[model samples]
Structures are given as C-alpha cells and as structure tokens.
Target: MNTKTIKSVRLSFLLVGMAFLLNSCFNSAKKTETTEEKAKVYPSDVIPIMEQFSILCGDGTSFKDLIKKEHKDFFYVTNDGVTDWVVYKTPNSGITSRTSSNTRTELGQTETWTPEEGGKLTGTLKVQHVSTSGDARVAASYSVVVGQIHGKEGHENEPLKIFYKKFPGHKKGSVFWNYEINTAGDDNSGRWDFSTAVWGYDMSVVGTSPDTYPAEPEEGIALGEEFSYEINVYEGIMYLTFKSKGHETKTFTKNLLKSDFSTKEAIPQQIWDLYAAIGRDGVERENAYAGEIQNFKQGAYNQTNGKNPEENIVWYTGSETYNGDIEKQYANGCYAEVWFKDASIGPGSAPNKQ
Candidate 1:
C-alpha cells in the first residue's frame, strides 16, 4: 500500500461518516413531524374542570373518562381566531337518553348533591345556531338548552334549564330559563315547565301560525352574542345571575324546597296557556324537588324534535329530523351548536357572600 492508497481509504471513511450523520438527522426530523401530527386538541385540554364530569354525545355515546378525550363532531375544541372555545353540537334527531326524545351533547357532573347541600355552575358562552326547521307555533322549537340542574330521583325533573332560541329568518334570539315541576303523583304525563325570560321573551311567546313569527324582541340577543350565567343553589334556594355586554344584568331567586305551584290556582297563567292544550295542568308536589339528588349538566341540549306539534304543543317540535339521520339533519339546518369559552363548577356560595 502506498501513500496515495492510504489517502484514498481515509477519504472514503470520512464520506461514509458524513452520510450516516445526515441520515440520522433526517430520521430524527421525520419522527418529530410524525409526533406533532398525531397530537390533538381536546375539550378536556381546553377546560381542565371537565375531568369532574362525564359526557353524553348526541349519538348516545357516553364517556366517563373525559380527560384528554374528545368525540368528533359532537364535543371538541376549536379556535375562533381570537379564543379557543369548547363546542357542543347536536342534531335535531339522534340516539338520545332513554329518558328523553331529544338529543344532546352535554356533560353531566359526576358528583350529586341535594338542594340543601347545594352546588354552583357557571359558563361564559354564545349560541352559534339552533334548529332552523321547526314549527314556529311550537314553544320548544328552534331552542337549545345550555345548562341544567337535573333531578336524579323522583320524577327526575329538571329544576332549571337555561335556553337560547331563535325563530327562522330572525337575526336575534331569546335567552330564557325553565323550571319543570315535580308532579304530585305517579302520573308524570301532567308535568309542565314554567319559563322566565333572561334577555328576551320567555318560552311562552310563540307564533300563531306554524310559519309566522312574533315581533322581534327589541332587547334580544343575537346569534354569536356572548353571555354568561351563574347558577348558585345554596341552602335550598336557587340564585341565578345573567350578564352580557351591552345588555342589562338580570338576577333571580327561587326556593327549591317549597312549591310555588302546589295548588291549581298557583299555576301561572303562562303555564295554563302553554300546557292547557295538552291537558297538562297538574299541580306540583307540595315539596318541590326537596331532598332529591341532583346534578349539573352543561352543553347543547337540543329541544327540537320531529313529532307533530298538534300532538303536544309545548314539546313535539315538528321539526325535520330526516328519520334521525344526523348528517342530513345538520346539512338541512336541523341542529344546535353552542360554544363555551369559559366554565367552572364547584360548591355553592351563600347569597350574602356572593
């Protein structure tokens, strides 16, 4: 071997080393890209408090482990160019809870407490869309429930249901809350809900004809308008506070242990008008939701259904469900969508302390 041969061998060794180094660097870069692509943003990532709750998708899928989990097209997180929002979306018709005919993509609190042992839930959200294919004469049509305090026992009635509703072709919608009575006897068929307005008209305001609409509320909330609500159930009393920019702040109080509609005469004229068509004039129990286990639910609980409104006026929205086909319902504007930028759940606070 001469000096030239030794130089040639040395040069080959250097070239091989360079090639190996470049290959290794390329592989490392590819691995990092793969990992980044696999990463996903979940609702629980946006809202850490979601770990304390379980989720029910509009397709009737239930999930107890929500940490870092998401259901596509139902419960997920998205950015609106300014802020990340957790979206809750559901169609007009889908597989619903056995107890309900309507569908929802909502979170149910894992912990349960009685009215006396209270709880508090808060959310800063906006309504994006509502079912646009329901009869205007139906009260529950074109509405979505944003938050609820649902009874776990007894008639399993909802003590509170916060709603956002808009009639088709209307730019502004109404924000309201309803309290369903715990019926006195086993016949739950006579159960009814009484509504109170928060920003616009209450649930009782509806069109005379299926396609007609009432006068647009002057102080109503429009779609994509931001609003916040705090439900603090403390010491058997529910204290509600609603706030929105450029809108008047409203506060309300109602006792949970005592029945305001225990007698037929105590029933509000609104209830009589809304429920009388269905023969649902039953009085509430003497003790309204007292000692009943209850939990909080937050998200989009779609109120529209496909049933004929003539069968039951208050419910039975007579919307176009497309035979429970979620995709068709969505494409045809028969869906509900809500976005929450902030939310929290914890123990209730005393009225004086709040």
Candidate 2:
C-alpha cells in the first residue's frame, strides 16, 4: 500500500479506539453514580424493627414496606445531616381505626401482652407538628399523641396516652401523660382520664375559647426538640421515665394490678373539674387493668381530629379534614409528624433508676 494511504488508515483506527475508550469511561462513571444512590440509607434500613411490625400511614393505608421505602406524602426517611429519622406523618383528620377518630402514621407491634404477663416498649422521638385548629377549651386542641399503651380486650380502652400539646402563638408545648379509666360497669359512658403533667399542662387544662391562649408554661418543649421515654411494665408495675435536655427528667410508677380509682371518691380532683363539663363520672374497674390484654403503639397517634369539639371536648378537635382528603389536610397544616431515632420491644426488664 502507498505510505500516505496507510498513514490515513492508521489515523482512522486511532480515532475509533479513542472514541471507544471515552465511551467506556462515561458508562463506568454512570454506573458508579447509580450504585451510590441506591446504597443510600433508607427509612427501614435505619429502623431495624420495621420488619417486625406493621405500619399504618396517615392516608389510611397499612403496609409492611413503609420503612424500607418512602411514601412521599406520609411515611418516609429524612436526614438533618446529623442523624437519620423515620418520619410518621399523619393528618389530623383522615381514615383511622374504627374506634378512633384521630389518624396516625405509626408502627404497630406484632406482639400483645397482658398485665399479668407484661412487656416493655421504649422510644426516643421528636414532635415536628400538631394540628393548629381546635377549641382551646377542648383538651385535644393543638395536641398530638406520641405514644400509647392501648388495651385490646374489653372496651379496648387505652391504659396509657402520652401527649404533647401547645396552644397557638405559644413559644413551647406541654408534655403530659393520661390514664384512661377501665370502666367499672358494662357502661362506658362515664369514663374519664386522669392527666399528670410531665413538663407542661395536662389534658384537663384548657383555655376559654378557640383563640384564647393560656399562660405559657414556665417549662415546656419546643418543636424539633428531642425526648426519650421508656415504658417498662415490669411485673405488674408500669414504670415510666421521660428525659430531655434542658428539661427535668420525670419518672412515674403506677400499679396495673390494682385500681386507684375503683370508686367515684377515689377519682382525683382534676378529673372532677375536667370531666364534669362532659358529664364523665365513670369509675375504674375494681382491679383497674389487671389481666387485660394490652399492646404498645409508638408513632404519631394524632390526638386532634375534625369532629365537633362541643360534642366530645376531650378528643374531638373539629380540625379541618378537607372531607377526609389526606394530602389536602396535610397541606393545610392539619397533621401530626413524629420522628423516632431509636426504639425497642421485648420482655419486661427490671425498672431503671430515676
């Protein structure tokens, strides 16, 4: 072949080789980028127990992959760049359990326990938002339930309801606990809750109107603040400890085997003042929740709802539900968002020191 023609052919081959090399590098880079994205930690990966439980979303859907994947509008994972959190975001008014008006995007334990054979549940979480609507006089206004020990048998009354409440324009919110009475007789009409303030006012403390504000709590929790709680039902005692930075650590102990409010006279003065407005004077079972099958629920079990507050001031908030449209209610600031960093469930352990 002529020298000039051979040189031209060699140059053409050289160009093709260069082009192939560039294409291979680009493909490798793309593959690496996709791998890194897929390897990113997800909500379920951080929450190890998700595989052991069921999740109920704020939009009224129940699924097992909530933690493993993202629901976008409801359950998902987010990072503050410091820590990862599994968010339980549910609307104030949406489809919920048949027995509850409030909606929740939370985890349900697979196991159940009774007072006689106890179990324990623990979690560390933060509240991001609560319903902004509700009458000030109604106990559930501007509040959300973060955790609970719901009874499964009998009237299915909740033995424990942990709450976070803040009034409008307030700088901080209150953290409190409530004990729902296990009805003494077949009638459940007279049931009442005895609230104990942990860091702020209890459920019984209410304002005079929907807009009227109460005195700011001297010590209250702010949004995005972190708190820890351990509900240890060791033997027959329900030992609870609540801890947070810049706040006093509170501990409480209650007997599940015996009834503290077996009779009307045994009810605390707070009950009389709080429930009298609603005509709730129900007495507790003589044995309280003894032998009752109970299970622990951890997540955003919203306390606020869209029912008329006057109809049932204790739980009905009449918050905007957008006619049960979950996404719309979420957009309208009618939802509860809770994020848990860590949690555990197991057989009851020995009580921890205060």
lDDT by residue (173-277, candidate 1, tens digit) is 999999999999898888899999998899999999999999888889999999999999999999999999999999999999999999998999998888888
RMSD of each: 2.7, 3.2
Q: In model 2, which residue pairs have backbone atoms overlapping below 3 Å?
A: 44-67, 190-282
Worst 10 residues of 1 by lDDT: 37-46
Candidate whose lDDT is highest: 1
Q: List the residue pairs that clash in candidate 1.
A: none
Estimated TM-score for each candidate: 0.93, 0.89
Model 2, TM vs. native: 0.89
Model 1: residues with Cα > 4 Å off, grouped in runs: 1-39
Alpha-carbon error at 80 in model 2, in Å?
0.9
